[model samples]
Target: MIPSGHPDAPKLSPLKQLHWSKVPAANTRKTVWDVSEESIKLDFNKQILDRLFCSKTNMSRTGTHSTLRNQDKITIVDMRRSNNIGVLLSKYKLTGPWVVDIINSMSDEHLNKELVTALIKCAPTSDEEQLLQSYTGSKNILSPVDQFLVEMLKVPKIRERLNCIQYKQSFDSLFEEIINGSRLVERCCQWLLKAANLKQLLHLILNIGNYMNSGTARGNATGYRLNCLLTLSNTKSLDQSITLLNYVAKIVSDRYPHLLITSDPLLEAASRIHWKELSNHLVSLQQGMMTVQKEVERQQSTVGMDTFTTKMNQFIKSRLDHLRDAANIIRGVEQLYDTVMKYYVEDYSSPEEFFSLLHNFMTMFKQAHLDNLRDMENDKAIRPKIVHKAERIMCQRSLSTTSLPRVSLNLAPQQEENQDTVRSSAAAAAAAVGSNSGSSIQTKSKGLIKNFKNIFLRKR
Candidate 1:
């Protein structure tokens, strides 16, 4: 695959090289005319000049405005043709830079696509068969515009200008990000190695982890992988009510609160660093550097220590040397991190991996610490209310226990009176019924008494 922003020139697509051939019309009437090359060139130049300066008034005076406006209008076509645009270029003395300037002056909206299309007519081929048929029919192609573009590409300066127009903005932004991000990464890595508080915090984490894993076979492992830090919040007690990270946060708060913010810079660096974008940026910078080097080499050969190219060469060399130094620093930072991780009984293979682990742990640690402080504040606010509710419950239980016996004693007489009343009602019902229906009346009275007892029990 071609590297992005490379110095090597791009190959022209197949459409640009299409071979257009003449197709004869059967109904055309033969006519004799004397058309000289000079007249033809003059006519072509006049068309260009007229188009550049033409306005509505001129078109109206020439009686061609209606032909231009109407879709169905048929007018006489220009019959003059050429195999190349060399004659026009020679007449105008238009060099590669001049062509580039014209192209650049056009709006970018049309420059990317429309300009190329306007210069030539693409051959119509829907499939391989059609393409093969086109190839068989035409070997001498009419591609004057394509030939012009090809000639311009032969000039290094023109080619560079074209490449810049296409890719300059994106490459510059990417390279800027790479340079800034390398500095941040290197700084973070250095801080990680030298910061005393960070080392102490890691020690605390290691001790707590070992204690938690005391009974397991892996408890005494000499080292850990950086990724294991992400599971700090997931490690739970037997009851699964809280996490290891929460406990760790509490310990840090009670003992060493300063370490809580130690990972902030590291976390920020990790978040801002984009591994894939950085890698791609570096590759592109290398390619762009190669392009500049090639251009400088060309200038050195042609002009020999000219002011413009000499300054450009110096700038490129200095920046390239700085970039190379950054690459070396990055390598050293990775090595230093691996060493530190190994010392702390951990292993990490990449800066991205190491920084990601630290970032996740730092995030979880901050959240857990904040949650712990909030919980403490809530407890302080509601402690009195909880105590008051407990006291009220105890007082009600004591009152119920002390008055329950007196309450029972007072209800004993009432229970006797209710039994007497029930007996009198039963006698009345029995007297109202006949001796043969006495059994049914007795059963009815018993049900009524049971319902009354249930009601009294419920009320009590």
Candidate 2:
């Protein structure tokens, strides 16, 4: 039976080792350990020696990240002093490629993952200019694994794929596949979303259309970009929104599909962009559209109103039916003169000639609709005058004279003649006036009293 530490680790003894691939993928990793479940442990003490060149990758800025922390049994890292690590790396003679074989061939999930992580921590954070110069102690050339990891950081394709990936996967077998598989992706979805700008992604799409239709190179643009733009036009998500417009220059070429590009630039802006600014920009664009619509409507209304007025004016000028009654009288006399002069005033042998001309004129005028024309003219001419006259009559008022004289001279003279009669005359006059005044007051007061008395008496 093949032992666990046997040289032939690729194929294990079925009865003792449980050939991993034979088991379901879910339970494949459960190994028969020589010790208890807690016996498997991590040795961070050897970390300074390992400098795991295999696992280091570019720290991604596009994705969310936490500082690599020391967890419990899963993975353990103590906050070690950099001086300690530096002193450790100094003594080591790392004779061969540190990460080459582990990354290229290793299948041990735990050791591989931990070693890569340790390598990432070893990467120069503060003085990267000096660290990259060292080249990880490789005099001839860096190993494929180390060089690939370093280069993958800058690749737009890799960075974007990494960003799209799940944040926490306990094992990283798929991580390498994800990185390598990015190059195999057919559609430029990752590029479209990952591009720095719409125009850049658009250019890539245009090239794709030009070169990569159904994996066959047909040299022309596609409906996909146009459709993409239309789709993007409605999206608020920046990554989704700009997929169309990125290559407009190429899509349209010399001949523009639409003379008006109705896209809102704010929609195609970066995802991390401020939403408030985007909202403001969109509002301003909407206001612009509203202003344009209003101007168009106003102009149309003005033109329609003008055209209606012109038509009415033309209709009015084509007829002579609106002469007033007073004006018609003068016009009729002039007509009579013209009719009479047409025959009699010239060389009429009898009055019959004059009648003939008058008859003909009347017949012609009737055929020309002069009767209806006259009534219309008369109504038009008289309407304002009638209204004016009615208004004047309504505004006028007539007041009746009071029976009492405005001046009391006549009353005073009558009183003075009786003045010699003195106090008795004055007293008698005053008594008569007082009696009349008192009677009027008594009548008013009695009437008011009667109304009140009647109301209360009825209620009671």
Question: Residue 244 error for model 1, in Å?
Answer: 2.0
Tens-digit lDDT track of model 1 for 1-460: 6642233423211122233664455433352234556557763343343344433222466545332221121111112323234455555555545555554453354444433332222111124223323343222232443334443443334434344333333445665677677667767766766778766777788787787689998686555665677788887878986788888889999988887853576556665676556766677777877887787677678756644355555567667775686567556655665676765555554566667777777787889999899989999989999987875564334323322221232346546556545444434434433332446644654454455445456444
Once model 2 is optimally superposed onto the true structure by TM-score, how far is the C-alpha of residue 448 displaced, in angstroms? 99
- TM-score of predicted model 2? 0.13
- What's the CA error at residue 101 for candidate 2, in Å? 2.2
Global Cα lDDT for candidate 1:
0.55
lDDT tens string, model 2, 1-460?
6543344433211111222335455564555533454666643433232223213223358843233322111101112534443333444422124433332232245323344444344433434323444444432243322333344333222221121111122213322332222222212223323334444434554665566355455555443323333332232335552323333333443344342122222222222233233234434433433443444345445544333234333433432232222234333433443453442224432323333332342233233343344656899999999988864442221011112122322335546543333323323333333445546644543443344334434433
lDDT at 198 for candidate 2?
40
lDDT of each: 0.55, 0.35
- Model 1 residue pairs with clashes: 223-345, 224-345
Which structure among the candidates has the greatest lDDT?
A: 1
lDDT of 2 at 189: 22
Q: Estimate each model's TM-score.
A: 0.50, 0.13
